[model samples]
Target chain A: MIPNIFRLTLPILFGYVPLGTAFGVLFATQLDYAWWLAPLMGVVIYAGAGQILAVSLLAAHAGLLEVFVAMLVLNARHVFYGLSLLRQFRGAGLKKLYLIFGLTDETYSLLTTRPRGGSPQEEHRTDVAITFANQIYWVLGCAIGALLGRSVEFDSTGIEFALVALFIVLAIEQFKALGSQKPLWMGAAAAGLALALLPPAQQLIGAIVMVTAALLLQYNLQRNTTLTREANHD
Target chain B: MTEPMYLAAFIAVTALATFLTRVTPFVFLSRHSEHPLLQHLGQFLPAAVMTLLVIIFLHRSAHWSAPTFGLDAIGPALVVVVLHLWKRHALLSIAAGTVCYMLVQQF
Candidate 1:
């Protein structure tokens, strides 16, 4: 079971380690905290981008309230992740708490596309195992990078592009799974519009709101079209 | 060195805020799991949300003011999409794409 879980989350392992290392190096080089604090943030916060943002915010001496609000808004896309997993996690038991806590973009992508375990009990174990393995890779990377950052000179520029690739791969996988261009087009349009109109700070939430409204409007359109056809048949 | 108390408070506040973002939908929408609207979103939101994320990242990666004008980002992004479509391996595509980005930016 443990080996299988590792295999399932191997891609995430590849992505998280380097990304976490980048975060750690950045934190260690820029901030005033000890190197160990990087991995500690990896364990407690567990958000790649959010952790990076926090480091920058702290370095800039942003207030606690500012950090709180910024982190919340930065991670707001997570709300949609939980909505999609509502059915899969219905009876996930106490582990559901941890599952929700660790529902990062990569984890959510992996969980949604994989086949379920044989039974509900096995499924919960698999979920927990996958989540735990990913975090271990993350924390391990943070430790390595932070230690290296303190002692060595390393250039990690362009390394974080791995995260961009991860998102692209997952988006392609989702497209193939759905076999529909509607979501892709709708999402791109919403993102484009939000990028055009909203500030960087608000773009993510703006796009999410726009996409949800568009999806609901699409649902109503389909329902109306079906009813019109039925009435004509009658 | 930053004070221990300040660091702890910073971590706690940021972690709590991030967890709240993740757990909000589950807390509010778990009971509506069977509703048609929620069901519709479950079926469709993943793809849409994933697309949005990709776009956001691409925007971030692009060099809006540089002379190359985002060619670095677009070139490697194309590599990623094409490689994944061909091999269907997530790690391979990501590794290749990152390498491509790193190499492309060197010039």
Candidate 2:
């Protein structure tokens, strides 16, 4: 079980290690009382971007309402992820709950790319292992970064782009696999429109709302048209 | 009150939101779902969500508010896109892209 978990999550470490390290370094250097906040955020929040924003807001002494709203908005996309995974979550008992809690963007993508292909029991083990391994890498990365921040002084600038790079690569993989650019274009268009119309802070939520609405509307329209055509044929 | 106390409250609020976001779909689907709609969203939404992320990154890296043709963003993103296309290895592709971005930052 351990070996299988390691092998499955090994690829994720490449991205998580560096990305988590970037967050750690920033948390350690930029924020006050850097050490505890670094790994503590790693354990609790566990969402990468939300953690980064936490550091920024806490350092600035942002209001609690402000912090809560920002974190909620930043991580809102996790809801969309749950929609796709609901079927898989059924009949897994309590572990389905853990699976939901652990559904980070990378974890979701990795699982989708290669499902836990085994018996129901084996699948449960594989998922638990995968989630554990990924979080372990993340927590370790934050710990290392906090320690290094206390001890060393060096340039680790531009490392956060590791995340941007990761997302780009993942998006391209999904694009290639789907072999249809409709969703891609629709989503990109929604994001672009949101960026133009909404404020910077609200752009993410706006983009998500826009994309989901557009996609569902198009889906319903297509289905209705197909139904009418079938009725005509009949 | 101390910073840790404040931080704990902050973490709790954030964690609640995060957990709510994660569990809502399960709750929603269990309550009610149109088979075609839910299934279509499950199949197609990942691609769309990923694309949304890709554009978000593009906006961040490029710094859209500046109103200039920014190579800072484009050059490295292109490197990632091209490298992924060529190698088909996730680690190699990501490494090449990060190194490219880091190097570009030097200039």
Candidate 3:
């Protein structure tokens, strides 16, 4: 289990460190923000999306209330991920709090695939271990980034697009893992439709609505397909 | 912006909010069996979340009316989609996209 965790997390660790470094450099040089604050943001926020939003809001001189509201809405999905994994960490004893706190998107993705038939205690340990590993990687990345920013002639121009590419890859991976084209198509359609209908400020809300509607459509389609299969069997 | 004060406040507030979001569900769920509505919602949340993320990516910039089909932007976007569809790796997609973006911008 330990070896598996290490292998799984190593890629993420490598990828995030440089990206974190880019972020640190951007904050320190471009924004003229403090150097140490970059890693501090990483450890505290632990969210790629939220960190970007925070930066944009700060740049725009957005009020604190606006930043808070935006962060809350963007991160509301984590609530669902946490709820789904509740049973896994229910009896985690002292580690439960840390486990929950470390439940980033990457960590959650890694934890969802625990091999079956372990003792509940073992399962809990594995979940917590995976979560810990991912957070440690993020922290390490952020720290390296902060330190690297001091001497290196760091350039952040155009690096922001990396996040977009990362998400596209993640979306494709989710599609492959779920073995369904319906969800992907639904997501793309919803995004396109929302862009057409909503104004800029309300675009996020429109996308959320479309996504929820797409999920419902997928659920119904899936349910009907299953019922038909069962009927055929009967 | 005074660096220390802004940084300190940003860290404190963000940390508090993030911690709350992460911890709330664990506390609620550990106390009870999963409710049916929660389960149903959970099942759909990932798709919804991913969809929203993609929308943000596509329309983040304010210049929606004048889409810049510049190679610096569109080239990388296309490369990312292709590499992701083919390689299915996050790191590769990012590296290829970045390189594509840089190369296009240089020319």
Q: Is candidate 1 or candidate 2 better by lDDT?
A: 1
Off by over 4 Å in 2: A1-14, A29-34, A60-66, A150-154, B1-5, B31-34, B63-68
In order of lDDT, best first, we have: 1, 2, 3
Give the winner by TM-score: 2 or 3: 2
Rank the models by TM-score, top first.
1, 2, 3
Better of 1 and 2 by DockQ: 1
- lDDT of each candidate versus the true structure: 0.85, 0.76, 0.65
lDDT-superior candidate, 2 or 3: 2
Model 2: per-residue Cα lDDT over B6-84, one tens digit each = 8788778877778787787888785444487887887778778777877876677664345546677777878888988
Instruction: Report the Cα RMSD per candidate.
Output: 2.6, 3.1, 5.4
lDDT of 3 by residue, B1-107 (tens): 66566656766666667767778777667666466545554554554456456556645621334345444465677788898888766567777886766555444
True contacts kept of 3: 0.44
What is candidate 3's DockQ?
A: 0.37
- For all candidates, state DockQ relative to the true structure: 0.69, 0.61, 0.37
Estimate the overall C-alpha local distance difference test score of candidate 3.
0.65
lDDT measured at residue A1 in model 1 versus the true structure, 0 to 100 = 79
* Top candidate, metric DockQ: 1
Q: Tens digits of per-residue lDDT for model 1 on A1-234?
A: 777787777767767887888888899899877889999999999998899898889898788999998898899888888888898888988999999989988898778767775787788778888888988989998888788885645544676687788888878888887888899888899999999999987888899889999999999999899999999999
